[model samples]
Target: MKTIKILLPIFIYILLVDLSYAQSKQNKKQSLIKPVVEPPIEVERTTPNNPDQYQLRLIMENDAFGGFSDRYYTNGSRLEFHMSAGESNPTRKVFSYWNDLFITPNEKTRYLQGFAVGQEFYTPTNIKKADVSYGDRPYSSRGYFTNSLTTFTEDTSITTELELGMIGPSVGGKSAQINFHNFIGSPTPQGWDTQIPDSYSVALKTDIRKFYHRFFGTQYNVNLGNIQTDVSFGLIFRFGNVDKTPGPGSSALQPGSPILHEDGKGYWYFYVNPGGTLQAYNATIQGQMGSDKAYKSQNRSSAFSNWDSFLNNPTPDVGEKELQYRMLSEDNGKNTLQRYILFNEFLVNGTTNPYNIGLNYLIFNNIFNGAEEIERTTRLFLLSNLSAQWDQIPTNARALAIYSIFRPEGGKLPPIVRYYSYEVLSQFILDPKQRETLLQLLREEAEYRDNKTYIADLKRAVGFIRAGFVSVSNAGFLFGLHYNYQTIDFQAAKGLPQQHQWVGFQLGKVF
Candidate 1:
C-alpha cells in the first residue's frame, strides 16, 4: 500500500507535466496564425425616437419569416399587425393585430390609451386520437381575447390601467398599471381563468427614484392576484450622452444598448433585474376517463367496472360522451396530471454599450408533493462583449464570450458539469489573403489532434468568408468572415474517469 501511494503521486505529477507541455505547444502554434486588422471609421450607429412612432421591421429566422408594422397616427390612435409562416408547418399560420384609441385628451401631463388585440395560433399536431380506451389524448387548443385601457397622470406621476380578458376557451379579466417614478408597471391585480364568475380584483404599485445616488437607480414592480403573484426590481445606470432622436440619422443613444448605429452616434445603458413569481391553478377533468379519482380506479382494474358510470353520463355531466370524443380527438386523456411550479430569476443586461455584459440565473422547483414526482433545476449564464468601435471592424464585429452552469436535483452522479467556449470575431471587406491563412490553421489543428493518443482534450477552430451582399438601407453591402473554436476533454475511465477532452470545428457561422 505504501509503494502504491507513492507511485500514484508520481503518476499524477507526470500527467500534469504532459498536459502543460501539450498546452504550451498548442498556444505557440496558434500565435503563429496571422491576425487581420481593419480601419476604425467603418462602424455604424442608430438613434431612438418616440415609443409611439410607426416602425416597420422584417425578421428572417431559420424556420420562419415574419414582418411587423406599428403605426401611431396623429390622432393618438395606433394600429399594429404581425404575421409569420414556416416551411415545415406550412398549414399553420400565426396572425396578430392591435388597434389603440386615445380616450383621455393628449397633453403634456396626462392621457389614456384604450386598445384591443386579436390573435390566432394553429398547430396541426396539437390534437391526436388513439384507438385504445382510457388512453392518452394528444390534442389541445389555446385561445384568448384581451382589451385594456390605460390612464396617465403626468402631474401626480401616476398611471392606471384596466384590462378585461379571457383564456383557454373561457373568458377572464386582467388589469394592471404603473405610477410615475414608480418602478412597477401595473396596479390593478390580474387574474386568469378563475372559478369565480365576473369578479373584480385590485392592485397598487409605486417606486422611488435615486434610491442611493445619481448613478444608482432602483425600481420595483409587484402584482397580487387571485391566481398569480409577481415582484420584480431593477437597477439601472446611464453613461455618455447619446442621441435619442428618431429617423435614419437622429441619435438618442443610451449606454448599454446594442451598438449597431450609423456613423457619428453612440449610446449606453446598464441594468440588473431580480424577480420572483408564484402561481397556482386548478383544473377539472370530465368525460371518458373523467376525474382523477375515476382514472386512478380505472387504471388499477383493466375490467370496465364503472362502464355505466362513465359512458351513460349526459351532456355537461361529469362523464359525457361527446366531451370524451373531443378529449380523445384532441389527445387530452393522460394519468390526470396536475402540477405547480415556483421560480426565481436574476438578469443583467448592457444595452448598446461599448462594453456589455449580461448574467442570468434561474431556479425552479415543482410544488406538487403527492404521488406525482417533483423536479428542480438551477441554471446560470453569462454573456460579455467588447465593441470594436475604435477598430475598423464590421458594424456587428465584437469580442464575445459566454459561460453557463446547470445543476439538477435528485439525479445520480454529480451533475454532468461542463465548461465550453471562447471566441473573437471581426468583419472587414472580404480579404482572400486572410481567408487562406485561416483555413490553413484550421487544417493544422485538426491534424495535430488526430495524431495524439490519450488525447483527453482537443481544441478546434474555423473561419469563414461571406461575400453575399443583402442591402438594407445602404448599410454598405455586408461582407465578412467568422472564426469559431471549441475545446472538450474526456477522462480515461481506468486512470481518472474525470479526465477527458473533446473539441471540433466546422465551416460557416458557429450556430
Candidate 2:
C-alpha cells in the first residue's frame, strides 16, 4: 500500500511537467503565426502651389570724375551724384524704391501687384559760363556774364512704374507667366543737361518658367514692342533653405551666406541671362536740327561758341539752325531715313547662389536699306561672362566685342567706315590675406604695363581700392577701381594728327 501511494505521486508529478511543456510549445507556435502591425506608413509633405508674398528692393549709386575735356577746358570738379549729366560733380541725390505684393487663394494659381518709384535731384550750386561750338564753322560767338560764372542750378525729376499680372497653372512641371507693365514719367538725362521729354511706354513679356528639370535649366523669354524685340535664355541654380509658401515667387529662399538646404528642400536660384535685341530709333527732331539750312545759316556764328555761352545767348540763332539742320539731315528729304540699332548682352548674376556663366552673340542689320546695303551695314556683337565662388576667391568676369560698318552712298568721305571695340574685366572678392596678395599682383601688373602701350595709344594704368566699415549693420565695404581706355583713328584727316587716345577711371559699380 505504501509503495503504490509513492508511485502514484511520482506519476502525477511527471504528468504536470508534461502539461507545462506542451503549453509553452503552443504559446511559441502562436507567436510565430501572429501577423506584424507596422507603424503607419510615412509620407512626405510637399509645398502648396499658391502665390502670396511681398518684396521690396532699393539700389544706390555714386560716381567721381577726373578727366581732360575735349574742348581743352578742365572737366572741373563737383560733389558726386548718381548718374545725371548736368549735375556733374555737384552733389546730387537719388532715391529708388520697388514694392511687390502677391496674392493667391487656390492651388496652381497666382496674381502679382507691383509698384516702383524713383527720384533724383541735384542741389543748387554755382555755375560758370562755358564756350561751345558746332561743326567746322567758326563764325558764331557768345559770352556768359556772372559772378565767377557761379550760379545755382537745381533740377529734380521723378518716375513711377507699375505692373499687374497673373500666372497660369503649371503644365508638365512648367509654369507660364503673362504681365503688363507701364513705364511712365520723365527722368533727367545722364549729363548735366537734365532735359528729357515725358513719355509713356508699355511692355508685354511671355516666357516658360522652369522649363527644364530643376538642375538642367530654366526658360527663354520673348519680348515684342516698339522699344525692343528680343529673346533671352537663363541658367538657374539654387541654394539655402526654402519656404513652404504658395507659388514660386514667395517660396524663394531668403538671402544669406553659407546657405544650407537638402535635396527636395526649397532654395534660391541665380540665373545668368544671355540675350540680344533688334532696336530702332528715329531722332527726327535732332536730325532736322542738324540738316536745316536756314537754321544753320542763322546760327552760324553762335554754333562756334562754347555750349554754355551759346545756351545763354539771347539771339541763339545757332541753336535754332542746329536743331533745324539735324531735323533735315535725319529726314533725308524723304521725311525720315529710319535709323536702326541692334544690341547683344551677356549678364551674370549671383544674387541667389552658385554663380553662373553665359555667352551671347548678336547681329544688327540696317534692313531699312536695300538688301545689298543691309548686307554692308550689318553690325555684330559678341559678349561672354563668367561667375564662380571658390574658397576665398569669388569672381565675376566679362568680355565684349562689337564691330560696325557705316557706309554713306553719297558722302565725300570713304564709302565705308569701320569701328571695332573689345573689352575685358574681372571682379573679385577676397579675404584679408587674399586681398593683400591680389593687391600686390595688381601693382606688379601695373608696373609692367607702365609707359607701355597695353592697348592702342594706352600709355598708363591706374587703379584704386576702397575699404570702409559702417555702424548700422557693421557692414564692411570693399570696392576696386574702374578702368577704361579708348583709341580712335580718324580717316578724314589723313596725316593731320588723326589719332586720339583716352584712358580714365570710372567710379561706380563693378558689374
Candidate 3:
C-alpha cells in the first residue's frame, strides 16, 4: 500500500510539472509570433481645400485721411499679395520648414505667405518750411520690400516678416507728397532737401495674438531693425458681429482674404486697438544709420547780419552745399553747428561717425557780456580786428556766448563788421579816426535792429508712440482713424502742437 501511494504522488507531480511547462512554452510562442501594439495614436492631417484663394491688398495711411491735416505721418501706401499654401502644395513644405526654424506651430495649423512693396513718408508740422524744423522730425521717407509668413490655428496666429528697403530722397517721398498735394491743392512740403540721408534698411518683425468669442483679443508685436524697432502690446475690442475669429482674416495680417464665414454674406465690424508702443528706434525721426552726415557747413566770413542777408549775400548760389550753409537752425549758437550725434549715439544702437568739425570759433571774455548790447557789439568788432592777423581769436566765454546768440543783424552789427576783419583793418583799428569810423558804422547799424535773437536749443528726441486707433472693416474694405495726444517728437521751440490726428485706410480684393 505505501509503495502504491508514493508512485501515485510522483506520477501526479510529473503530470502537473509537464502541464505547467507546456503552458509556459505555448504562451512564449504566442508572444513571439504576435506584434506588440501601442495605444492607437491620433494622427493630425490638414483639412483639404482650405487654401481656396489668393488676395491683393492696398493699404493707405496718411495724416490727410484725418482731414485738415497734412503733416506728421504724412503718407504711407503699400501693395501686397497674400496666398495660402494648401496642404499638398510644394510651397507648404517650404513654409513648414521656414516655420519650424523661426516660430511655433502644430500639425493642425494653416500657413500663408505674403510679399509686398511699399513706401512711407513723414514730415514736420510745418512742411512748408524749407529747413529742418529743429523741434520736429526732419523730413523722412522710406521705400521697401517685405516677405512674410504666417501660421494660424482657429483663434490664434503668429507671423514673422523680413523687410528690406532704403530710406532717403531716393524713396520718392518728396515727389509723391508734392504730386498728391498738388492734386488736392494742399500746402506742399518744400524741405525734403534735409530729409533723412540714403541708407540701406533691414528689419525683422513678429506678431503673436490670441482671440476669443471673436470679439476681443490681445496682441504682442516686436520689430527689430535699422528702420524701426519697437515692442507693442495691447488689447483689441470689436463692436460688431462677424461669424469668424477676427485674427486670420484681420487685415493686420498680411493682406488677408475677406472674413467671409458664409459666401455672399458681408461682414462689418469696428475694432479699436488701444496700445502702447515702446519705441526704441525710428530711422525717419532720428538720423539714418551710418555717419550722421557726410559733411557739415560752417559760418562763412559770417558777414550776414540776418538769414535774409545770408540769402541775399553775393556768395555763389551753389545748390545744396550753399543751402546747407543756412539750413537747419542746428546752429543754435548761431556760430557753429551743434551735433546731436552724441545724443543720437546714446539713442540708437547702431554705427555712426561724429563729424570732424574743426573749431573755427571766435572766443570772447565774460566782461563783454555784462556790458550793454551796444558795447557788446562794439567790443566784438574790436576783437575781430585784433584777431585779423591771427589764426584764432580769443574772447571771454560769457562775452562770446552773449554775442553768439544775438543775431548780428538784430543788433544791427551789419555785414561790414566782419568784412573789415582783414589784417589791414587791425593796423588802423587802434587809430582814433578809425575807431570813430567803426563806431559810426555800428551806430548806423542800430537803425536796422529787430527783436528776435538766439534760437532755442534743438529739442532732444526720444522714440515713443502712445495713441488710440480705430479700425473699420466692411466687405473686405478697411478704414482706420487715429486721434493721438502726442509725445514730444522733435521740437526746437515751444508752441508746436502736442496732439495730432490722422487717418488710415486699407482696402483689399482677391485678384
Candidate 4:
C-alpha cells in the first residue's frame, strides 16, 4: 500500500512538469510566427501639374546714380563719384515683378533651367530733380535743318522695362539668371522742360556674382546692367516647394512656385519704404547779389571771422562749421549777402557711404572698438537703419551708457537703457519695456536746446527701427537699410553730376 502511494505521487509530479514545458514551447512557437506591425511607411506626396506651381518674384530697389561733369567742381570733389563716392546723389524708387510662364518644362539643361518674362517700373522722385536727354530721338520735321544741332530734351518720362530672364543651375541654396531687358518710356509733356525722354533701349543685365557662377546663399543680389550701367542691389525671398534634391541645372526651390494670385499659394504683401528718396536730395541754389561798395571796401563782413572761427574752434555747432555760405540777395536794397547751407547733412561724424563700404568691407570689419564698435557695426550691417538716429546719441552719452553697463566702478545706467544696450548689442532684441524706457531716456536727452530737434528726430527714427526690427511678425520679412553709390557714365558732356550717394531702406518678402 505504501509503495503504491509513493509511485502515484511521483507519476503526478512528472505529468505536471511535462505539461508546463509543453506550454512554454508552444508560446515560443506562436511568438516566432507572429507578424510585426512596422510604423506605416510614408511616401512624400507630390502634386502633378499643379496650377499653383508657377513661380513669382518681386524686387523693390532704391537706386542712386551720381557723377560730376567737367562743368562742375574742379579740385576738392573731383574723384568723388568714382563709383558711389560722390556727394551729389540722384535717386530712383523702382519696383519689379516677374513670374514663370508655365511653358518651360521642369527639365534641366546645360545652360537653361527655366524661362520668365516680367515688367519693371521706376520713377525718379528726387528733391532737386533734373532732366536728361533720351538717347532715342523720334524723326520730326522740325529736325530736318537742325539734324546737325543734336538738341537734347529733358527726362520727364515714366520709365518701363520689359525683362526676359532664364534661370541657371543651383549652387549652395540659390539660383541665378541672365536678364535681357528692353526699356520704353511714356512721352514727356510737349515742351522744353521734358525730363528723361520717352525712348527705347535694350540692356543686358546680370548679377555681379554671375561672374563666378556661385550665388551666395541667395540673401542679397548685386546686379549690373550694360548700356546705361544701371546698377542695383536687392534682397530676395522665396516660398513653395524648395527643391532640396540635386540635379543638373537645378534650383534650390522648385520652378513655377505660385505667387499670391487666384491660384495663389500664400500671403499678399506691400511694403512702405521706411524713408523716401526725399532724404536723398540736396538743393544747389546759387544767386547773384550786389554788395554795397562802402561795405565791400571796409571788408567788415563777419564771413572771414566766421571762417576763422570754424577752422579754429575745437568743436563748433553744426551751423558754425562753414556749413553755410553767404551770397548777395536778389534785392538791390539789401546790402547783405544771403547765406545758405548745403541741404544734406552727411552728418554721422566719421563714416563713409555705401560705395566705400562695399569696396572695403574687409578692412573696416574691425575698425570700431568696444561698445562704439558694436553700435557702428550694427549701424553698417542694418543698412536701411538711418545712421543719423545712432549718430544723434553723443559720444560721451554712449561712453557713459557703456560705462554704466560694463564698468565695475561706474554708475549704473537707467534700468531700461541698460537693458537696451545689451539688447541692441545682441541682435536678439525682444523686450518692449526696454524700448519704452529707451524712448523716455531719449526724451530726457532731448531737453537741451542744442540737441532738442536732433533728439526728437532720433526718437522718431528709433521708433521706426523698433517697429521693423523688434516686431516678431516682421521677422520673416527681410529689411535692409543700405547706402547706394552708383557711378553715372554720362555719354554726353553737360551739367550732369558724376558720383551719387543714396541712403535708403527696402522691405521685401519671398512668396
Candidate 5:
C-alpha cells in the first residue's frame, strides 16, 4: 500500500538503531572503541511551510473508453491535489505583492499548488432520445472547482487557474448519467430532462511552456469565461525517459507522466503531445452565454412544427461560425471543430522512497468539430422551415439518395458520398407537387438526415480514437482502460448501427 506508506519511516529508524547498539555494548565492556553509523537526513521542502510532500489525482473520460457507442464527447471526471513545487506559492497568501510580479523566486522555480473537483457531461446521438434530439449535442452538463498555481523554470512553465462552476440540470446530468447507466447495464440517458440550464460559472485559465530541448517545445493556451472562450498553440514532443528539464512530472500523466524521486529512485517514460484549438465559445456547444435557461423546464417544442411551436421554442443559438449554406451540404469535417489532439505514452515504473508505481500505454487521437453544434442546429432547423416554400429550398436529395442504400458507411463511404444522391433533387424538384412536399419533409426531417453527415475527404474525421491501459500507484495514483473510437457523429434516420464506441476507465490516488 504505497510501499508501506513510504517504508514505514525507514522501518522505524532501523529499529531505533538496533536498540541503541545493544545498550552501548553492555556499558562499554572492555571498550573496544568503534562506533560509526549515520543515515536519515533528507531535506528540500523549500517552504509551503515544509509540506513534506503530497499528491493525488483521479481522472476519467469516457465514450466508455471507446466502446463504439455512447454519445458526443460523453462523460469526464476529475479530482486532483498536489504539493511541493516549493520555492513559494502555498496559495501565495494574499498574492504577496501581486505574486512577485509573476513568480521570480530563484533557485530554479518550481512553485506548485493545485486543487480540483470536476464533472462534465454531454450526450446525443441517441442516448435513447426521450425528447429534443433535434440536432443532437444538446443535453449538457458541467460542474467544477479549481485553483492552481505553478511556476517551473529550467526551460519554462507557468500555470494558472481559477474556476467555479455549474452549467445545467444542476450538473447532475441526469443522475450522474442515469446512475452510471444503471451500474453499467447501459442505456438510460433520456436527455437530462433537456439539459443546459442553471447558471453562475466562472473561468480563467492559462498555460505556458517554452522548452527547447528534452524533446522540443512550445505551448500557449487561454480560456476566458462564460464557460469557455479560447486561444491555443501547441507542440511539446518528448522521447522516452525525457524530463530532466521541462517541468511538472508529479505524475500528472499527461501522455503519461510519472517522475519525482528524491532517493526512492525509479523511472521510465515516453510521451507525445500534439495540440490545436480556436474555439471562441462553448457553453456546452453554444448555449448559456448571456441569457440562458435552456428553455427553463424543457420544451424544445418537440424539435418544432406544431404549426410553429411557440415560434421554435428555445433553439436558435447556432454555431460553427454561423453556417448558412443551405440546400444539400458539406463541411468535409462537419461543424469545423477540427482541432488535432494526440497523445501516446508508455510507462513502466516502480519506486520506494516517496512511493511510486507504474504501468502505461495510452494513445489518444482527437478530431473534433463534428458533432459540436449539431451541424449548426441542423441548418437552423432547415432554414426556418424551408423558407416559406422554396425560394430555393427543395432539399430531399432524391430521398436522401434513396435512403442511402439502407445505411452502412458508418465510416469510410465518401466516394463523393452517394447512394444515388438523387441527382440534385431530381434535377430541381421538378414540380410533382413540389417534389412531394420536399419528399415529405425529407422523411420526417430526422435532424436533416442526422445533419446529412459529409466528409468528402479533406483528410478524414468522424474519428476520435482513445487507446488505453494505465496503472500507476502510490506516487500519484491513476488507473485506466481505454479503447474509444468515433466516426459517426450523427446519422440516424432509423438505422443506428453504432459508430461511437466506448470502454474507458481511470482511477487515481497519491497522498
Candidate 6:
C-alpha cells in the first residue's frame, strides 16, 4: 500500500510539470501569431495645394522727391512691370525624387525665399531749364517791364529704371524686401541743353506689408546716387489662392507638380508728395514798380528814348517811314536772339498792353505706330500786358496783306497806338495729315526767320511794321489750358486724358 501511494504522487507531480511547460509554449506561440498593438499616432490634415511659387505685378507711382524739378513739392510719374521667384517653403518636402538629389527639407524654415526683377520708366514735369544758352532771351533796358523776356523756360526729363531685389519672410504681417533701383535720365531732343549728360541715379528701397499676402505696406526709399530720401506707403489687392500647405498621401516618396497655383490678379498704387508749394519769392514786377525814378533811370538808354519819342509822335505816314531797328534782348544776363518771342509772334496775336495776347501750340504724337496710334495735345494761352503809353506808326492797309507783313498805303492822318495780330495761321486745321504738314510748316518758319533777307527786312520795317514793336511789359497775367491723351496698354486698350500745366511748386530757392 505504501509503494502504491508514492508512485501515484510522483505521477501526479510529473503530469503537473508537463502541463505547465505546454501552457508556456502555447502562450509563446499565441504571442508570435498575434501582431503587437502600437500606441496611437496623430495624423494632421493638410490642404491639397502648396503655396504660391511665382508672382507677377504691375506698378504705377508718383514721387515728389527725387524728380526732374529743382523746386520742392514737384512730382514724377512712373509705370512698371515686375516679377519674382523663390522657394515657397523649404522645410516641407513635397516629392521624394528631390530627396535623392540631396535637397534636404528643413522643417524650421516656414517663410518664402526669393529674388525679383523689374523694369520701369518715369517722366518728371515742372522742372526748370538751368542752361543759359538755350533758354535766355534779351530785350529792352527797362528791366522791370518784361519777366518772360528773361525767364520763360521749360525742362524735359525721362528716366528708365531697372530694379533687382531679394524677398524675405513676413514679419508682423508685412513682407520684408530689399531692393536696388537703377535709372538713367534722358534729355528732350527739342529743348536746348536740357539733357543732363552722363547722368544716372540709383535708389535703395525697403518695404514691409500685410494685406492679402502683403497687399499693404510702408516704403522707405533712399537715393544712393544723390542726396534725396523718401518715405511713402502703398496698397494692393490680390485675387488668388495664397496657401502653402503640403497635401496628404505619399508625396514624400513620389514626384509632384511644382506649380502651386494658377493665374493671379493684383494692382499696386502709391502717392508721395511733401506738400503744396508756398509763395516765397519777391514778386519781380512788384519790386521793379516800387519806384518810378528807378524805372526811368533803368530805361534811360538812347534806343528807349528814341522808341518813346516815335511812339508819342506817331502819324498816319509813320507807318510808311522805314528805318533799321535791331531786334535785341537780354538773355539771363547777356544779349541773345529773341527766338522764342519771334516763334511766339508766328503763332500768337499781341496788343500794346502786354497782358492782352492770344496764343496756341499743338503737338501730334505717334508714340507707337506711325499713323494708327497717333495722339494729339493742344495748348492755348492768353495773357494781358498794359503799360501807360507807346508811339506807333501810321496804319498801312493792303487788301492782300499777309498778317505779319504790311504794304505801304500813302496816308498821314494822326498820332495813334495800334494793336497787332501776329497770326501765322488764321485758324487751326485739325486734319491728321494736315497737322503733320503744319509741323513741317513751323520748321520752315523757323528757318525763314534765320534767313538773311528776312532779317534785313525785319530790321528796316521795325517801326512801320504792325508786329514790329515786340514789347513785353506787365507780362504776369496769364491763362492757359491743355488737352492731352495717351495709350497705356495695348492688350486691354487702356488709356485716358491727362491734364498738365507749366505752373507748380512755386517754392523759391530750391537748393
Top candidate on lDDT is 3
Please identify which of the two predictions, 2 or 4, would achieve the higher TM-score against the true structure. 2
lDDT (0 to 1) per candidate: 0.20, 0.21, 0.48, 0.21, 0.44, 0.19
Question: lDDT tens string, model 6, 344-426?
Answer: 45323342322222212110000000001101111111111111111121133111122211211111101110111211222
Name the candidate that leads on TM-score.
Answer: 3
Could you give candidate 4's per-residue lDDT for residues 1-511 as a string of tens digits?
Answer: 1222323344345435534654675467567663674433222112221221112222222222122211111111000000110111111111111112111213220011112222221211111111111111111000000000000011001112222221111110010001111121211212111111122223332321111111111211111221122222322222223222110101111011111121222222222212111111101000001211101111112222233343343454635543332111111111111211121122111332222222122111211101111234544553433333446544543453334323321111133433333333322221355445434543443232111110000000100100111010212232333333333322212223434343333332322
In model 1, the Cα lDDT at residue 378 comes to: 16
Q: Candidate 6 at 27: error in angstroms?
A: 52
**Clashes per candidate, residues 3 or more apart or on different chains:** 55, 47, 9, 27, 21, 18
Instruction: Provide the global lDDT of candidate 5 against the true structure.
Output: 0.44
Query: How good is model 4 by TM-score?
Result: 0.21
lDDT tens string, model 2, 45-143?
Answer: 133322122233222211222232221111111111111111111111111221011111123322222222222211101111010111111111011
Candidate 1: stretches off by over 4 Å: 1-159, 169-271, 280-511
The deviation in Å at residue 437 for candidate 1 is 77
Question: Residue by residue across 229-348, what tens digits does model 3's lDDT show?
Answer: 777676767766554454333333222322222124445556666555666777676666455352222221121123223333343444443343233223322222232232222212
Q: What TM-score, computed on C-alpha atoms, does each candidate reach?
A: 0.22, 0.23, 0.55, 0.21, 0.29, 0.23
**Pairwise TM-score winner, candidates 1 and 6:** 6
In what order do the candidates fall by TM-score, top score first?
A: 3, 5, 2, 6, 1, 4
Over 340-422, each residue of candidate 5 has an lDDT whose tens digit, in order, gives 11101110122111101100000000011121122235435543443333333234432332223222211222222221232
Which tens-of-lDDT digit does each residue in 1-511 have in candidate 1?
Answer: 1222323354345435534664675567567766664323311111121122112221111101111110000001111111111111111111111111112223321112212222111111101111111222101111111112122221111112222222222221111011210333211111111112222223222221222442344433333433123343444332323222111100000001001223223333222222222222211111111122122112211101222233343345534533332322221122222111110101012222122222111000110111111122211112111222225322222211211222221121111111011011101211445434433443443344223211011112211111111111222111111111111111111211121111111111100
Against the true structure, candidate 6 has what lDDT?
A: 0.19
